[model samples]
Target: MAHTLAQKILQAHTDEAIMAAGQIVRCRVSLALANDITAPLAIKSFRAMGAKKVFDRDKVALVMDHFTPQKDIDSAQQVKLTREFAREMGVTHYYEGGDCGVEHALLPELGLVGPGDVVVGADSHTCTYGGLGAFATGLGSTDVAGAMALGETWFKVPPTIRATFTGTLPRWVGAKDLILRLIGEIGVDGALYRALEFDGAAIEALSVEGRMTIANMAIEAGGKVGLFAADEKTLAYTAARGRKDAPLSADPGATYERELTFDVSGMDPVVACPHLPENVKPVGEVRGVTLDQVVIGSCTNGRISDMREAAEVLKGRKVAKGVRCIVLPATPGVWKEALKEGLIETFMESGCIVGPATCGPCLGGHMGILADGERAIATTNRNFRGRMGSLESEVYLASPAVAAASAVAGVIAHPGSL
Candidate 1:
């Protein structure tokens, strides 16, 4: 039996030898995570469990990112409670300030996740760790509290579905476009409770950052996890991040329950418009759609590479007179690197507002809110109605390049056209 990355991680953690789909199985967890918004609730639930302390404080991580810098009283209180709990539990890995960005972005950068590990977080984007060949998934706050007490969690083995892509993507086509297209084809709930394994030459050609972008959005399609096998590319990425000795890859002969094939050689850049992530249309079809705001950052596409790509498009071009553009780096590390590379200067020269390294407008928290009837084109993962602002506003989701190009044109435009 040839198992995929998801299968290997599940089997390694399983207490039972013969696990079947839909049958609950107890499994060991390599790491557990909670951020400010969810950590307070998880802590409350843990106390209700009457546990002496966390099963292993070292295995738990607390990150204050969702409301970094604390905007309102409720958010401030959440951060305070999360910090108090972390201090009392003696959690070794606690991230705050600019050190905390999106939980998924900070986890891999801090070496908290690695191949062959099973991680759980209270944020849906936790599945981004699957890019490192880890079987990571998101859970409810109560479920995280249970994992904190027992160091284990129950899971029904997910049916594996492999998405194999062949052929080179076009200049403007990116991982975001590919995943959005998949969501369009499968609908929002098509992959419910299933493991999505990406394979083939096309996937192998993508960088780790690109792969993370794909895995990060799997939740929007209702997938448990979007997994990619660890090849040399995976090894090199972790190695560069100071985890040179980390375990890597799944065993050969891994089994998959189903497979899908995509021919993206001629694929066009896509836009997930108005409300739903799955409501995708090719950029060619919607190139002239006007936008009031354009954002180029999020857990989905907020890495240094993503910033650089957008910066390149913004250079020598000012944001459209009436359009406001916001650029947020995913983490302080990414921000510092972009600064060192002069990418920050390019963005500022183009009249783009560089926000703090946080989730920012991706979740409609701190930046670029739209007024009634206003429209935005953003690089964030979801464009669900009212996600970025008022219910009357509209959002179109695209790659960072697309967002940047659109910002300069005052309308949706492909990066190549810039």
Candidate 2:
């Protein structure tokens, strides 16, 4: 019997020599992660279960990125609770304040996750690590508690959906556009409980940051994991991060439940329009839609590459008056790198506000929340109603380049339009 990339990783972590799709099995976890929003609940569950010490202090990560800088009394208290718990458990990966970044980006940058590893987090975008060929997925707070205590978790092996991308990406089009196109084609529930195994020349040629962005949005398509084989690009990325995991691949005869192919040679910049990620349209189709704000940062497109893309577009340009453009770097390191590379100066010169590394605004948490009836474009993952602010406000999702261009145009426009 052959196995998909996800199954290969799952099998390595479990005692079972063979496991089929939909079969549940117990597997050892390489890392268990949660953030300020989710950790408070997971910590409470950890105590309720009467587990004194975590399975391994080094294996548990607690990040405070969502509502950090102490948004309000409730959020501050939540972080306080998580902070105290981290100290009590002697957690080695606890991060807050300047040390913390978006959990998904922070973990991989720190080499805490690698190929063939099994990772579970109390955050849905935890599938981001699957970009590195790890069998990663999200878990509820309670389930995260179990993994933290036992160092193992159970999963129903997801059948693989092979999505092959051919042809080179057009200028200004990137992984974000590709993923938006995919979600639009499949709808939200298209790949429910299935692994989306990305492949072909285009996917293999994508940068590590690009791969992570695509995998991070897998949840929006109802995928169990958006995986890619640990090919040269992936292995090189891991090696640069100080992770030494060997590459892994699916068997030649691996079984797939379905297959989808995309040719990116002619695809244009696209966006997920107001209210839903699946409601995508080419940027040209939605040109001239007014906006009140534009955000360029999130776990999805907050990497250094994304920052560079935005800076390249905004250089010698100004954000349209009345539109509040906010740029957020994914991590402290990424923030610092952008500053050193003069990207921060470029954004500030363009009249955009540079914020700390937080999930702010993306989750309607704070910092850049939209006013009622206001419309904004963002590089964040989701665009659901009220996702960024008031129920009446609207969010349009696009890549960082598109977000920056829209900020300058004061409307939904493609980067090429600039």
Candidate 3:
């Protein structure tokens, strides 16, 4: 039987000569990642397992990015616990303060993630690394602890759902829009426990950063993993940093549980409004809906390409009165690159506050909390209840272009409206 890219990677990692959907396999992990919110729990569980040391210290990366700068004493203590464990384990990839961004966004930049690798993280968005052709997914703290100790974790091979994007992607329409459209069409649980593999000419034309945005949101649709076939863009991104990932592809006759195709020509910018990431609507449909704040950053849309897109829309323009716009680069590296390109200056001159590389407002940890009855447009992953602060506050998920345009208009405005 032919195999999908995910199956191929899994079969290679597992002791088994073959792996199929629904089969359980314990595959060796190439990388293990955790953030401040999950690392402490993983460490505690690691200790409970009577493990004297991690299976591979150099492969584990513990980052303090979710509540960066330490939201408070409790958050600081949580980070401290992870730090001590990392120090004791001699973990080589530990990231502190300014050294880290969101683990999903930073690992690729460091050349620590690559194709055909089995990567797992304690955070759901870890699948973002799948943009590089790796078979990556998120596991619970206990799963992480188990993987940390044994260098492997059990997985029930998920059936693949092939989503093919054809035609040219319209200007201002990005991966965020494409993924949001998918969620809207299939609902949030559409791909529950399924591996979503994206392909076709449109997806092929996407930059690695754009592909990362789509892959990062696969979990938002209940996907086990989101992947793109590693192409030249992916190879160039990793190879320049002294890493090389052999490209992998699904066999021509690979079977899929379900198949979907989207024709993206002239696709409009879309948004996922309050209460659910699947409640997507076209950006023009939400025009004039008042907003108190706009956030243009997160693991989902905080890369340099996203920054350039936002800056392009906001350049020579000022934010609307009574509207607050906050922008965060995904990593310190992204921050530096944006500064070098003057994207940071454009944002700041437009009345947007450019912040450090942090998850910040995306998880309501800190930096830009919303008030009661306030509404914000953000380029983050989730927008469920009380996700950004008070339960009364609302968040609308959008692309960085929509985020910037909305900030300038003080509403959920479209770039065309501006």
Candidate 4:
């Protein structure tokens, strides 16, 4: 029987000989992850089960990113608890302050996740791994604890939706715009419990980093996962990272519940307005709207490619007066690469504050929280109410190009405006 990439990957790890959508099946997990905010709870759950140790320490990753450097005494205690658990379990991918970064970005860079793998993390952005053709999804802390102890978990196979892209994306119009437009067309609950499979020439042309940006936000549209099938690009990335994993692809006649097509050549830069990632509109539709802050970071768009794009727009300009601009590198390694490439200097010289690899500001962790009535245009995934700070604050989601341009104008702007 022909199967979609998601089904194929799931079957490879599943014990049953035949599996179909909606069928509950137990499958082996290739990787399981947890972060500072969720790891403590998962660890507590793990201990309560009286599990001797993790199923496979090397296959689990623990990252201290959500509140890195410790937000307060409670956060510090949580971090300490996570550290002890990781140490006790001999976790091979434990990341702490200074080296910690958003787990979604760090895992891919380390080659800890790859095609055909079943990965689960205690993070909505764990879907980011699906960009590499992995069957990845996010789970709760208790589920994570169960996976840690058993190395396998049950899943209700989600039906698939294939979105094919055609033509080249216009200059300044990036993956973020494409995704935001998709969310707008489909709404926040569009793909509830469904797998979104990306394909076609335009998707193939996108850099893995760009695909990561799109896959990272799948949760915004209520997708079970969003992925690009294994192709030459997937192999090249894995090889470059000095890791090897079998690439998987959907059969030619694989099934999908519905299909959508996008023509990037005619697309424009888009932004998701305050309160919902699906409240999207073209930049021109909301141009000149004032902003209180601008941030370019998160697991979504804080990689080297994102930094380079933002730096280009800010090369000879400064962040608008009174509008703070914060630049976060997605990982320590990404930070070092950006620094060596002079992107860090370019940002700082342009008056944008360069921050560590932590996921600060994106989730109201710290460093750039907003005050009441404040509005920020950012490259992070979500833009829900109070996502960055006070309940009255707002966030607008855009591409690095739009973010950089808006930062220079102190309002929502576009790359063409710059």
Worst 10 residues of 4 by lDDT: 14-23
lDDT of each prediction vs. the true structure? 0.87, 0.92, 0.91, 0.90
Question: Clash totals for all models, in order?
Answer: 7, 0, 0, 0
lDDT of 3: 0.91
Better of 1 and 2 by TM-score: 2
What digit string (tens of lDDT, one per residue) describes model 3 on residues 311-365? 9999999999999999999899999999999999999899999998889999998
- Better model by TM-score, 1 or 4? 4
lDDT of 1: 0.87
What's the best-to-worst order under lDDT?
2, 3, 4, 1
**Residue lDDT tens for model 1, 1-418:** 4456676677789768634556677899989999888899999999999987988988999888877778889899899888888999999888889577777888888878878889999989999988888899999899999999999999888887778888898887888888998889888897899989887788888988899999998999899998988778888888878876455554576676777899999898899987999899999889999989998888899998799889989999999999999998888898899999999999999999998877767787876788889999998988887888889999999999899999999999988887
lDDT per residue, candidate 2, 35-133, as tens digits?
Answer: 989998998899999999999999999999999888999999999999999998999999999889988888888889888989999999999998888
lDDT of each residue in 1-418, candidate 4, tens digit only:
7898888889999878645789888999999999999998899899899998999989999999988878889999999999988888899889997767878888898889999999999888899998999989999998999999999999888899888888998889888888898899889999899999998888888999988888888888999899888888888998889887666789889889999998899788999998999999999999999998999999999998999999999998999999999999889888999999998999999999998888899999898999999999999988888999999999999999999999999999988887
Better of 1 and 2 by lDDT: 2
Model with the higher TM-score, candidate 1 or 3: 3
TM-score of 4: 0.99
